[model samples]
Target: MSNIASILNESEPAAKPAVEAGDAPAWNSTPTTIGFGSVGRMGSGAAAEPPKDADAAAAEPTKGDASAATNSKEDGPSATVPGSAAKIASGDIPVVINEEDMEGQIYSNAAWKDLGISDEIHRGLLSENYLRPSKIQARSLPLMLSDPPKNMVAQSQSGTGKTVAFLTATLSRVDFSKPEQPQALILAPTQELADQISRNIHSIGRFVKNLKVALAIPRKIARGENVNSCIVVGTPGTVLDLGRRKQLDCSQLKVLVLDEADNMLDLNGLGDQCLRVKLRIMPPDVIESVQVLLFSATFPPKVQQWIPRFAPNANTLTLKTKELTVRGISQMFVDCPNDDSRYDILCKLYGLMTIGQSVIFVRTRKSATEIQRRMTEDGHRVTVLHGDFDSTERLELLGQFRAGETKVLVTTNVLSRGIDVASVSMVINYDIPTKPGPQGDEPDAETYLHRIGRTGRFGRIGVSISFVFDQRSFDHLNAITTHFGIDLVKLPTNDWDEAEELVKQVIKKNSAQASYVPKVDDRQTEADDSKPEPAEAASQSTTSTKKEDDKPADVGW
Candidate 1:
């Protein structure tokens, strides 16, 4: 196992190995011993070792010094994974390139254990079976709960667990006993995400009781829904609707989260509405400020301009856990001379799926539907999903594909982020998303990351094939490579058959790091009322919850 895998296996909470596309090779497998030694032995147990490689240490992100709250035994328990004890006994440890880079090294299990979560909160976390906090959580948790939490801003790629970080911070500040008034207001960009977030809050605060988490959405109002829950997640229009009705009392709100603030402002004219909601509740005297949390997948000039209007004094916390969407996946781009040649290439790629798993991302809804019909008619077990599909149908289709029911799926951008299925061995950007606008509608590097990231996730290895049309497009591909600091290696493939064989050989050669993605059943149904809420939903819709414009230029962040 690589050092990353060994550390995960030793410290991660799951009892059985995670469901994987396949098993890792033995040579890359780790020896049983991890970072365990007697209390006084540095680099083992409780003792700290000096920095590892100097270069990597210098490369570490210089976020402010934020020690996780010194968690107690219950709050931050030692990992109980098998071999943890053996490692302590046999302490010849291997060090990372940046051990001092981990100085605040918040990924340690002790961080959460030391937080000293209340017995009730601890129980919730235990019931949910949370193994360890993501990097974002480790750093943000303590700071949110600090004596005087100055407002803060954090930027991390989506899926690094931004939601729970803020949720825990929000929950920690609330006096559960006195929540009759709004003590917290969470502003999400969409109705779907609002419901999703509400469900999570219910589970996390299950033991907290008396908390009235609520939902404000067009659906709720259109259907005349009543929400007694305190935490509210919804599109801006509906939230503002409730505020205008005086149904919401923001007077006591101590926390405000512009979940996806970038998207929040991208809403056609809704950004103004969101500001009004905040303005209505905030008192001018003494400048009564509420703790604010802002997260986004990409930070552009337009989005950054709106931050001050929402969180004027917030500190910024940037995270790079997902610097490369294909970090864990082997990637290559295939050059398809023309659209007609694509079908012939796909026919060959299909033969590979007969032996393994893969997905093909098309460019449009119409194309996805057409391909689904053609593939299905051609005797393929294929599923297609796009934005046009209703929520229920899309969810069902995803469930079906996730169960390993279908080997190949033809989808559009809907599959870009938030869905987790590590077994997928390949991703084909059937139609690469590029600047499609009349003059400048092409996608940027961030869009490229979301497209390819679907494959290599949760430490699993996968491959991405980007079909380039010309020298210009290949140059654009090169820019994507440079932007992420990843090597977009040229694959040895003159044809589709060769590319398919390449994937098989690659998977056999390099086993993915380790799989910690929760199983369908094992996935926490709700937040355990006992532990702090898991990082806020990565499904954040990224930060602000608004649908992207049909054209890429006006797309929501």
Candidate 2:
């Protein structure tokens, strides 16, 4: 067997020299150049002597084998799995290859052509450089596109191509014979997300003849105008209104998709609207025949319990808790001495790395405006978006950011959820997200997950740097990290050069670990405890501290 194959199948560790911390080689060094075998050169080496017997190898106690455990520990801290050696050796973020993910070879290994997609849609996918189906796409597509369509509730990590998976199924199911018939209805939580999904569908189905996609937004279509299109994408309110007014013909609607399902189903804002749309559009008799597909990066326990009622008897696919966070994202945080120092540290971030496009999320609109003004002064093209902006203005500003007219976007939770800008390589949590709880305010873990999810779309490498200035903020962040069971590497504000280097190292190490959990040290905990209290600093300092506006948005979800 090849070295890699043997390594994968072997029950015993290959004896090798152990190196201590100081003597250890650089993590990024090539495996072949060091002592480990390369993936490319796997079969080239001489064969090793055969084991004495299979019975003897089986006789050894695998469970609590001290020598085996010791060898594994001495090898490295990284997790071992098939095809992970190269990534571990090269210091790239490791991806877990699950056996269940590999069970369906036809969907997992086959190309778009092999999936029986149409020529026109296939051309469009190829044009956009989507060579094959993603994991979610591969698993969900066949089930969705089957002879008798199935209701599906899929929970995937952000940016794993959930949009395209559902889109493909929707496009494929559409009957072009009745071009004007609205066959597919996709509802998003926000107008921006709805608009973005509309654009993506058009782009993917560009070559299809008689393809009609209508945006059912307030100003996009007049009040009395009828929506006669093959597919309709819109916010719940607009969709609900159109359905209620009988402007949108849902009689022939074959598919109903809820993108960002958790947000849409949240009881606070759009949930009622979503339920109204579903009820108004689908009569009791036809509801059974219509396919329902729910997609989101998160489905919290509460949401998960509620989804079966929304999409009855749906085929559910979910990522385990440890696997919820996107593997490619390198999560870190900046330790600011004071709230004022956060702005200075924010400006320095752009110079520290090559950022394609970035989003900086703050707690309030006032801070967003301030940061935008300061960032503009620093010679960066900036765009600020918030709930205060009217729909038209919000659309225009988002257009500029999406088209790369502006590189830095500053906003509140308004843009946190489902906005997919492909080139966004970084997300800055200028202020950590929090929600009111019995103990005052606690970290909003779901919102934090969704906020950072903006950048790391479809397995692309991205970074999220959160800024924490006080004990409250620090405790919130710590809680969030603990909740997700992921490590948050600390970045110092004092030294730009040292901070930059440390950030790079953290990214490499964390990526290779693949597991999001970071090993915390006692020194780091001590340092966190020693941070000066914000109230004390405020009294001693000459500059008056601006009280942050913590007024919660009634419908920010």
Q: Which stretches of candidate 1 lie over 4 Å from their true place?
A: 1-106, 178-182, 190-192, 221-226, 267-273, 280-288, 319-326, 351-359, 399-409, 422-425, 435-438, 491-498, 505-557
lDDT tens readout by residue for model 1, 362-431: 7667888888888788877777876676656665777777687877888765455434555666778776
Model 2 bad stretches (over 4 Å): 1-108, 377-381, 502-557
Predicted structure 2: lDDT: 0.60
Ten-residue region with minimum lDDT total, candidate 2:
535-544
lDDT of each residue in 1-557, candidate 2, tens digit only: 13322322232223221222553211110111111112211111222111112111111111210110011111221212112212222334322223234212212344676455799999988766677766666556655665456577666666667888889889998998788999999987667777778888888899999999999876788888999899999878778778888888888889999887876765544555666677656676556578889887666544543455566645545544444566667787776777888898888887543346778888777888888898888886678887677778988998888687877788877777745666677789988887656777667777888888886555556788998777667656655654454666566555778878766554444344333321110000000011111101000000011111111000000
Whole-model alpha-carbon lDDT for candidate 1 = 0.49
Model-by-model lDDT, in order? 0.49, 0.60
